[model samples]
Structures are given as structure tokens and as C-alpha cells.
Target: MELRQLSHFLAVARRRSFTLAAHDVNVVQSSLSASIRQLERELGATLFDRTTRRVELSPAGRALLPIARHILADARAAKAEISAVQGLLRGQVALGTIQMLTWIDLPEVLARFTKAYPGVEISLLEAPVDEMIEALRSGELDLAYLACGVDELPAALTVIDSDTEPLAVAAGPDHPLAGQPGVRLADLEAEPFVEFQAGTGLQTVVDRLCHDAGLKRRIVLRTTQLELLASLVRHGLGLAVLPVGVAHQAGLTAVPIIGNTADRTVALVTRAGHDSNPAVRALLDLLRPDPAG
Candidate 1:
């Protein structure tokens, strides 16, 4: 198969409609479908199971989607890297972040990054911290902005100073205790809590907070997306612990947990040492550099 075929397949997979994928890739639907069919034929595997109303990945397709995405990403990176050798600012950077910051404004950071280096591509992937860390180590990601509290960085991963904020309790404005002056651990023991699945950074923080408070939280729901959790809170389903910044933008009442029980840190993580990729180094420098005189 050709690189273009993989690109076509990915577009189709993401949009889940051949017609829309064609518009996105600026190709006609027939050409796109032909390319995908050729790709499937070459691979000897069906990538998608289609119905008139919807398109879905088959089991094989589901497994191949991410691998295909990675391959396309690396291929694009390679092309961009070659262009950089000609003194042109070019090279792709894959950045991973948690869902909380997806709506954040980057000011000119992202704009300038793309404008000043038009040839370079920037792809952002949102996942839980575990998947982010795994992607970084596996070369699927060049850098990640994540919330981590472990004493040690992932092996061969370098940590950098990024802004951090505390995790807090968020509840709907109409919830019974929403207007309370302060929230105590004991107050929420029996409350239905919305939380991240186990092993995520914030989940660990919440678990520890409950443990230290000498109570166990009654977490009724688990989701990786903080905004979704906030929505659940707004629906009066349950309350959740989330980063203060995220909670603030989520339009929910966030009360700081009394005492020092709830807090988390956000940082930039990359493969460790000086041998880091130039694109990753450049982005880090842009984020944290000497003050302009």
C-alpha cells in the first residue's frame, strides 16, 4: 500500500463517513473509497464494516487504526524533518495532554508555532495520563503535558517545569452542599462521587485524599474526561475532584477541600536526557526560556 492510502484510511476512520473524509482530504469520495479498498486488499484485512447509516471499525480495523495513525504520523514527521535540513523551520511534533486542557487558549503559542513554521505539523492527542506516558515512551508521542505525582519520572523521561494548580471538589450549583463555606472529607463520605478510573493521576490523588481522611468515597462513576465528569455533576449525578483550573472553566462550583488533602501537579514530560528530538526541545524552549530583556 501507499502512504496516501493510509492517510485516506485514517481520514475515513476519523470522520466515519467516506463523503466527509473525502471533503477533509480534498479528494472525491470515489477516489477515497477506491484507495481504502486498495489498501484493504493489500493488507488482506477489512478495516471497516459499513452500513448505510454508519461506518464502524471491525475488530481488525479497530486494532489497525491506531497503528496506522502512528505510521502516518511518523511518515509526516520524517518528511518535515527532511525539509528542516534546508534551513526551513519544519518538523512535526506530537503532543499528548489530558482532556482538561483541550479547551484552553494557547494565545499565539500554537498560532505562531504553525505560522512561523508552516511546513511543520502539530498533532494533539488527548488521553488519560497512563496512555499519555505510554505513548511518549513508545515513540508515539514527542512530548506530553500531564498531571503526575509519582516521586520518580518514567524511566528515560525528563521532567520540565510547567504551571501546576491544585485539585478541588466540584459540585453542581444546586447541589445540597454546593454553597457550603468549606468542604470537609467527612462531608462527602457518603456522597456519590464521580471520579477517574484507577491508575490515573487525579484518581490516585482522590484515593489518597479519601484514605487520609479516614473515609472511603462512594464513587458512582468513572471517566477519563474531566469535562464529562463536570457535566455529570451539573446533572446532579455526583460530585468530583478535579484540577481547580479545569473546574473553574467547567462552570461548576469548586470548593477547595479543607486542610491539605486535595492537590495535584501538572508538568511537561519528555524522553529524558539531552538526546531529545529537536522539535521537542524547540517547543520546550518556547514554553520556558530566559526572560526577554
Candidate 2:
């Protein structure tokens, strides 16, 4: 029934390991277990099914997960609101982002936010788009940076800011297609490609472009590291689709696609109706583009 019990229960439900959840919440396993037991007793429902090898959420736990998240979010928002009334922001803001940090100018935004509200703590987590969206939905992240086409987003999410940029086909200087003008997606049908892993937003964009072009890319390597993917392309291992700035910085020859088949739209996203944290709001304001620019 207590907020602390709900907090412990949510950690356990997310991690599915009592020890891991205990570590996450900075508490001992026994204390966390006792809290979950107390919560379950108060609710008159079994929340987890525990075994020697694994722990799984019971039906009741699944049902309570979203409710617990909402309660925690509201509590945090209330605390932040109270703190803001004292002319100071003091709370933790967890932000999620993809790998393209430099392009987003996130460090600059962070610098401004920390300088303005030194008491507010900030944590940055990096994950793929799908994972980041899930974190936002689950209340693990107050804000997230994602990449999409900028047309429509999921019902549970809202875009704070979006910037659309053209995607470029990157190739080694010595490659046959290097410096080629007007390179269409189908032009690289037989070319090997080095791309991000399946779950990443960049990979999704590449897949969609190839699918629309009626071609399946010959992916020779799949990796999570953007620098490594660029390195592979630089070494003539395979071609890749990348943001124009990133491709040029990696010293790869970047050519624009002939059609509007591939473009990168980076968006700052948050849960649709959960924007009450003062720290989160401050960061979002700093990230917003200047009207004069």
C-alpha cells in the first residue's frame, strides 16, 4: 500500500530478479523482498512467480505494472513541482538517447541545464529506438531522443522537437560507386552493406528504404557501434546509409539518394501525457531551437 512498496515492486517486475532490482534501488535483497511481500499482502494478490532459475511476473503483477508507473510518475512530478516553488529545481531526470549524440548537440543542452539548475540530477541512458520508447512508456525515462520519418508516432508518445535531414549513401573513396551523383536505392541492390543491429532506428530506416526500392540489401555485417559501421564502410567492407554529417566526418564519400526514399528525422520524444517534471521541462526548453536561428 505504501509508495515505497510500489517502488520496490516495480523494480522487481522490470528486472525480474530480486537481486538485480535490489541493486537498482540501492537496497538489500531481503529488504526488497520484504517490501514486495508487504505490498502483495496488502493487495491480496501474488505478484511474482519465483523459481530457482528465473522469476516471472504473475498476472496480478502485470496488471499492476502500469498503475505503479503512473503513481511513481505522479509522485515525482509532485515533488518536483514543490521544489520548483522554492525557485530551485531538485530532482532526478532520466533521459534516453540513441548513438548520435554529437549531431543532437545534447552536451550543449546538458551544460546549459546543469548550469541553470545545479541541484537537479541528470542521468543519460543510451538504447535503440524501440527500447527507448519502452523505457519512456514504463516511466524509466522522462525524455528520449529517437529517429523516424516524422509523419506519425505511436499513440502513447509525443514529439517535442523533430529535425528532418537527408540520408546519404556512404562508400569508400576507391569504391566503384564513390562520388557517384544521384545514387538511387536500387543502384546498390547488389552492394554489400554494413548496418546497425536490427532493433536500432537507423536500421529500420535503411530496411524501409530498401523494401520500398524492391531490393533486399546484402548486409555483410550487423553491429551496434556506429563508428565501427563507418569504419567498415571506410575500409571498403561494405556501403552504408548514414546522416550526411556523420558520413562526411568519417571520411567516406557520401552521395545523395536520387529520390525521397531515405531521410533521417531525429525527434525528441516523451510519454503523451506525462510532462509535469520541472527538471525535464527545463531540459526540453534548452533543447528547443532558437527562433532567431
Candidate 3:
């Protein structure tokens, strides 16, 4: 009827002696006998045949013994799973990121955490910053990588600035602007640009840069995939503005927008007050700069 009752039943079933089972389970013989009596009364079946000389399993006791053992075992396993979640040993951590993160050194960042808590399994989903924010708000993602601002974050989530990488413009080696020096936005207005789909954080920065430079972009192609944008730039379809780290990782050349030195901060987003959640906290420790520093 209860896990404790089932546990006591198993101990008695295994030992076949009330006196021995009581000692083995650290209970008084009278208490153990009373618990078994209560269990049998609830089930309406006798679990043991008792004699002055010895105790043996009755038909109902024999039938319930194996079942009780299985139930006890399953209960312990469930408790262990819960403990592991608290200990950061066996739990699923759903993380979301923008496409640019696929190009960032996430493996290195993750390695620092995995080495310490290898039992936590990571599930990564790639989504744009906007979509990632939505996912985090909707509880679809346990954590997310995106530019930090939580105006749209559900009341339950927290945002922490993790790191920043400088943004730069990139082009193919054969592009006309490749060798140019100090080329302002006005000089490149005629060239087709490979841009991120509108509404992305990256595109917002690009739009801001173009606007600041008193120029309008000639977007020839738009994509939600950052890697594909880099590939298109490599093929000279158009130039792309991206984080310097991304451009470097994709084996593309990054040219700083002269006088337009823009940078975007990467932030770790998580369910608020889940700092107590071991897995999420472990990731946050890995993401943010050391507070001691």
C-alpha cells in the first residue's frame, strides 16, 4: 500500500523470518509485525502463515512478494532519479541558440561544464534570437543564447549578460571591396548585400550601422541561416555583416566597418530563480565571467 510497507514486506519475504527481517530493516519485531498486519488487512489477503516454531509465506504472500519487491525497487529508482536531478547527474537540459552560435566556440564553453557535471544530458535547439526568446518564455527551452533584453521574456525567466564579440562586415576574397581601404557605407551601397532575415538581432545591428552611415542597404538576398549567409558571401553573392568570431570560424575575411565599430553582447537566458536547478546553474557559471574577477 505504501513504499515503506512494501519495503518491509520485501525484507520479510526475503528473510522468511519476522525476527530476522525486523533486525535487517532496523525495526522492532513488534512494529514490523504490526506493519505487515496492516498491509494484509488493507489487501484483504493473508501474506504469511505463522506458527509457534516458524513463519512461512502463505499463497497470497508468495504472490505478492515478487510484486512488492518490484514496487520497492521502482520506488528507489524514482527517488534516485530525483536526487540526480538535484545533483546535476541525470537530467535533460534544453538549450536554445541562434544560428550564429553554431559557428561560435560553444563546444569549448560546454566542455568546461561537461567536464565537471558529465551526467547532465544537453539538448540543443537552434533558433533565431527572437524565436529563442519566445521559446524560453514559453518554457520550451530551459536556457537560451541571445542578445540580452527580457522585455518579452515571460515573467518566469532571467537574463544575464554573458559575453560580447565585435561585429564586422565580411566579403569574398574576389569581391571588389576586398582590397579596398576605409570604405564607408556610401561606397558599398551599390554592391548587393547578403543580409539576415528581418527581425533578427544581427539584422537590427546591420540596419543601425547602415542608418548611422547615412546609407540604405541594397539587400539582394536574405536568409535566416548565418552559415548560409557566410557561404553566399564567400561565393561573392553579397557581403554579410556578422560577428568577427563567426566570420573567422567560417573562414571568411572580416573587415571592420570604419567608424562603425559595433558590438553585440551575448547573454544567457534561463527561467528566473532556477539558479537552484543544478544543471541550469552549472551552465550559468560557465557562461558569465567569473564574478571574482
Candidate 4:
């Protein structure tokens, strides 16, 4: 039916709460509910089955969800295409990233993007890899900058672009391993480790390396905050395996891990086949690395 009704219905479907969905679309609960009711009336199908505790999408609603998303996407793409040909790009892109990602100059990219298309709005959310992936699938995030294993990424999303960085052991300057040119995986067994939260890509690399080496590290600290992880390592609480650039920027000594595949690849990821919009394409272009030096 109407785009606003579809928008409101889609919001409710994703959030599963009329109140919260209303909050998301910036409308009063009654107005949002009325819009959904009108949509269901026009379609002659019950869109949602509500029972106070939670709202579940009815079969008809589930059937219409994808169709609705496509319609909204096409409408937005049409509007954006006309604006782009007129030399103006206008839309909001919700981007997700992991903590302490230093491989790419994101700020510089955003700076130039803003100068070029001042009409566009951008928002960033720093989260763990798994969470970002889920948000991308659910349409909460438009694009994400994250790390992927050497293996293929999940089928739900596709890699638009990527960059690689070496993962090294970071230690305080006074730590014994700090001065070493290359530290063996076995050598780290004697030292306690400062680690990131379990689902993080960096943590995955650290865990995989130790598991492959048949050695278990004694983890002294586990955290999600970058500043705290850097502080713990700075105080000699434990050694950390992180991107070499991040370690160097944090003023810690970085020692290469010996005989291991420890490179972390950070990718520019988005939902597979979700690149129809010009605004998203423009931002993705800016994010891509320049071909020429």
C-alpha cells in the first residue's frame, strides 16, 4: 500500500514491538499502529499477531517482508539516482566497525566524503564482528568494516573491499619479550596474555594461533575496551596480540610471532546483493583503496 505504511510495518516487523518501532520511526505509538492497521486492511491480511508480551509477524506479514524491503530499496534508489545525476547525493548510511581498527584511515575518508556530499549523513557504531554481521543482515547497519578469517565469509554477506595487517605481540617496553625480534608461540606460554572479548577477530586469531601451536596461554585479562587492553599491557598485566600499527600507536613494543599465519584481514562488508543504492555505492567507492600510488 502506502510507503509510510510499509515503512511502519517493516519497522514493527524488525523490532517486534509497536512501541519501540514507533520510537524508531519517530511517531506516536497510536499513529504507527493505525498505519499498520490500514496497511493490513488494504492487503486483506493480518500482518502481525500481538499478545502483549511480544508481537510476532503473521504468515502473511512474513511473506510480505522481503517484498516490502525491496520496494523501499527501489524507491530510495530511484530518488537517490535522480539526485546524484543533479550533482547531489543525499541519504544516511549506518556503518559499523570494530574497536581500534587502525589499518585504514577511516577519519580521512569520512572527512573527504563529507566535503564532497555534505547532504549525506553518516553514523558509526563500534561493535564486535558477530554483532556487526547480525546488524548488517537485519538491515540495522548499511555497511561494516570488520575482520574476516582466511576462510570464505558467511553467505549472507559479501566483501566489497579489504585490507591486511600483521598481528603481533604487544608488550610493555620493560617486558622481557618486548626486545625480541620474533617471539615463538611456545615462548608465550610462560607469559600471561591480555585478551579481547571472545568473539572479536583479533581474539580469534590469537586463539587459533595458540591452538595450532599446541600451546595454551595464561590469560590474565579479558576485555572489550581498547584503552583498557592497552593499559593492561602497558602495566605488564599481560602481553597482547594486536595489529602492529595499533601496538606502535599505543606506544608498546611489537614483537612478531614466529612461524605462524597471523595476518588479520579487515574487510569492507555489506549484505550480499545489497548494493543497489547510489548513496551506499558512493560511500563504498570512497572506502575503496586507490589503485594508483
Candidate 5:
């Protein structure tokens, strides 16, 4: 009828002696006997046949032994799962990021997180900033890494971490502006460009900068792949604007944008008022910079 009573029943059945069972279970013989008696009474079945010299299980006790053992095992497994999650031992986290993730050191963060919580499963999705925001709002993602101006984020999202880095102009080796210093946005007015698609954060920044400079861009191609953008710039398809780190890594000549040196802030975002799972919390803790470092 109760787990404690079932436990007592199991102990008695296994030892076939009230005195021995009580000793094995660290309980008084009288208490163990009373618990077993209560269990038999609640079930309306005799569980044991006892005499001065010997004790044996009745038919009902034999029938219930395996069932009781199974129930106890399942209860233990459930408690263990709860504890594992609470202790950050097991769980899953889904994180989203913009296409340009090279600047965030995401691989290092993930490596450390996996080392700390090996049982936790992690899924990483890459998309444009707009898509990442939508995924966060729809609960498809637990957290997102985004590159945008802080003011551009919606009110429903919360910024967890943010850092600003300079944006640079990328050009092929043979491009006329490859070695130029302090290249102004207006200088590229007549140059054809390869850029991210319209919905991306980088595209938004590009549009704003071009508008500010009063120059209409000549966009020859648009795609979501940063690698493709770099490839295009490499083969002289068109020039591109990208993060300074990304541009340098892609083997393109990176030059500073002069008059109005625009920079983008990369931020970690989560849905406002959403409760984070244990795995998500652990990752956020790791991503947070150490004050002592």
C-alpha cells in the first residue's frame, strides 16, 4: 500500500526472518512487523506465513514481489533524473546564432560547456539575425547570438552579453581599393557589391550606412553564406563589407571605413520572461566573462 511498507515486505521476504530483516533494514523488529501487517491489511491479502522457527511468503506476497520491485526501481530512476537535471548533469539546450559566428568564439565556449556537462546535449543552429529572433520568440531556440545595433532589438528579447567590433571593407587582391587606407563609404558608391540577403543584420547595417552617405549601392549578388560572400570578393565578383575579424580570416584585404567608422555590437539574446533550462543556464554562466580574469 505504501513504499515504506513495500520495502519492509521485500526485506522480510528476502531474509524470511523478521529479526534478520529488521537488522538488515536498520529498523526495530516490531516496527518492521507492524509495517508488513499494515501492508497485508491494506491489500486484503495475507503476505506471509510465520511460525516460531520459520517464515515463508504466502501466494499473494510472491505475486506482488516483482511488481513492488519494479515500482521502487522506477521511482528511484525518476528521482535520479530530477537530480541530474538540477545538478546540471543531464539535459539539452538549443542555441541559435547569426551566420557570422566567427567573431564570437562560439566553438571555444561550446568546447568548454561540453567538457563540463558531458551528459547535456547541445544543438546549434545558424541563421540570419531576423530568423534567430523569430526562433527565440517561437520557443524553438533557448538563446541566440546576434550582431546588430542594441537599439534594433525588439522589446520582447533581453540582452545577456554584448561587445562592439569594427566593420571593414573586404576586397579582392586585384581590386583597386585593396591597399587603400581610410576608405570612405562614398568611395565605394560606384563599386558593385556582394552582400547578405535583405533580412540579415549585416544587410540592415549596410543599407543604413549607404543611406547615410547618400549613395545607392550597386548590389550584384545576395546570399546567406558568409563563405560565399568571401569567395565572391576573392575572385573579383564584387566587394563586401564584413566584420574585421571575418574579413581577415577569409584572406581578403580588409580596410577601415573612414569618415563614419561604423561598428556592430554582437550580443547574446534570450526571450524576455522565459525560464531557462538547466543546460541553458550552465552555458550562459560559461559565456559570461570572469571578473577575476
Candidate 6:
């Protein structure tokens, strides 16, 4: 069918609500519904099931999602290449990022980039490192800021810029280990830990470090929110291993780990060949401005 129909279908599929999708696409609900209906009529398959309160994608919708995404991405890429040849930058640049960033000033950078390239549309997604890597590989994302360990980067992804921070054991002021200058990784084996959710970058780093050090922690609470994790540790639910900056911000005592160099690396990564997209390149220039200039 038409490209607009595919776009409408995707909006509904993503939002799971005609109302929300309509608002997202800046169209009336009736218009969005008509587009979907027209698309279904042409395809000869129902794209969504609207029997219940929550709208769910039908089997046909599920089958079309990836193909639709690929088509749109290709279309956007073609448009961007054409615009670049005409000495203009236009189209979409989708960037993914891990939730925590102690170093980057992303909002400020985005403000500048959007002001500079008003023609380009930007989408920012917060996800775990692994998921972002997959998104970059699948053409869903042009760039991702992720926490990766040394030499553990995905095969098809390459880095544009990177920063590293040391990890520390975070303990409340009242904890017995609070005053320690350097706590060994083994010391945390018997401690109850307040940990990040499994998919998070910090959680992944902490798990690998513990696994290598032959230490098993008794995780008392797991949370996706950084503030919640900090609160859990502060209220003595458990100790946590976090970046020094995060520990300091949360007002926890950060004790360095003896003989451990499990630093967290935040890298701006992209799929190997996808860096050629003009919109993505413009954002990259903002992300790492030339020092010589």
C-alpha cells in the first residue's frame, strides 16, 4: 500500500492505542483509522485486533513490522543521500543510549544539534547496551551510547567516541565497610547487594566482575531506576557497586575495589557501514567537534 499507511500502521502497532497513535502522527483518530483500514483492505489481512480495551497486533501485523521498518529505513536513507548530494542534510537519525550517563551532557548537545540541522528529525531511545547494539545492527538506530568492557564490543559495531570511569563499592555511612579505604571484591561476597536490573549496563559490568572474581552476592533488591537503586542502598537494603560519580551523587561512600580494574566504558557506537547517513554524520560532528577548529 501507500507509505503513509505503513507509517500509520507502525504508529498504532507501537503505541497500542489509536488515540495515542493519532496524537503521535499529528492526525485525527478517524483519519488514522481510515488509513489502517485502507492498508488492511489492500493487504487482505487484518493488522490489529481491537476486541479488548488494549489494542494488540494481529499475526499479520507482527509479520509486517520488521518489513515495514526496513522499508522506512531504506526510504529515509535514500532521501538523506539525495539531500546530501543537493548540499542539504535531511531525514531521520535515531540514537539509542543507556539510562545512566555520568559524563555526557546529552540534552545540551541535542539542543545545539536540532538548532543547527532543523530539517533532520531525531529520535532518542533509552535501552540496555545489548538491545541498543542489536538496534544499531538492524538499522533501527544510527548511533548508541553504551557501556562496554575492554575488547567486548559487538562485531559489526564501531566506536565514534568513548569515556571510562572506575567502579566502586557503594555503602551507606552507617555500614561497617563505609570507612574502608579499599574493599576487596571478596569482601562483598557476604554482603547483601542492591543491584540494577539485569539488562542494564551497570548490572552487566558488576555481574561480570563478580563472576571473574569468584564472588557471589546476595542481591536483596533489583531496580531499573538509578535513584531507586541508590535509595535502596542508602536505606541499608544492601551495598552496591556503581560508578564513582553515581555513588558520589547518591551520597554513598565509594570505596575503591582492591586489585580490581572493572571500569565502565561509555562508547558512542554505530553499525560499521551506517555512519554514512548524512543526518547521523551531522550529529556525530556535534558529538565530537574538531579540536583544531
TM-score of each: 0.71, 0.75, 0.62, 0.71, 0.67, 0.77
lDDT of 5 by residue, 1-293 (tens): 78788768866776678987787567899999999989988999999998989999999989997787676645544543564557777776768777776655778989989998898878676656876776566555678888788788898899987878888889999998887886888877789999886767778887887788776779999886788889999999998888888888899998888888577788888875334365677788887767686
Worst 10 residues of 6 by lDDT: 82-91
lDDT of 2 at 163: 84
How many backbone clashes can be found in candidate 3? 0
lDDT score of residue 177 within candidate 2: 84
Clashes in candidate 6: how many? 0
Q: How do these models rank on lDDT, best leading? A: 6, 4, 2, 5, 1, 3
Q: Top model by TM-score, which number?
A: 6
Candidate 2: where are CA atoms >4 Å away?
1-71, 101-103, 272-275
Candidate 3 residue pairs in clash (backbone atoms < 3 Å): none
Model 5, residue pairs in steric clash: none
Candidate 3 local lDDT, 1-293, one digit each (tens): 78778767866765568887787567899999999999999999999898887788999998996577566545534544574556876654667776676334677888877787788766566545765665455444678877634464566667766566777778888876677664667667788888887766677767877888887878889886677888999999998878888888888888777776677666777765455456766776776666686
Candidate 4 colliding pairs: none
lDDT of 6 at 122: 85
Best by lDDT: 6
Question: Residue 250 CA error for candidate 4 (Å)?
Answer: 0.9
Local distance difference test scores for all models: 0.73, 0.80, 0.72, 0.81, 0.78, 0.82
* All-Cα superposition RMSD per candidate: 5.2, 4.8, 19.5, 6.2, 21.1, 4.5
Which tens-of-lDDT digit does each residue in 1-293 have in candidate 4? Answer: 89889879977886678987787678999999999999999999999999969999999999998788777766655655665575545676768888768857888988998898898877676666876776677665788988776355677888877888998889998998877899878766788988888787778877887898777989878986888999899999999888999999999999998888778888888886456556677888887777883
Cand. 2 Cα-lDDT: 0.80
Tens digits of per-residue lDDT for model 2, 1-293: 88889878877876678987787678899999999998989999999999998999999999998899888877766776776675554676888888854455788789888898898888776766766777788777888888765565678888888887778889988988885786888767789988887777777887888788877789889887888988899899999888788788788998888865578788888886445666777787787788788
- lDDT pick, better of 5 and 6: 6
Candidate 1 lDDT over residue span 1-293, tens digit each = 78889778866776678987787568899999999999889989999999999999888888887787678756755654665574446566777766565223444577877776686667776556876776676565777777776454676777766555777788899997778877887767778988876666667667787788876788789875566787899999998877877777889888878866577776777764323345655666665535662
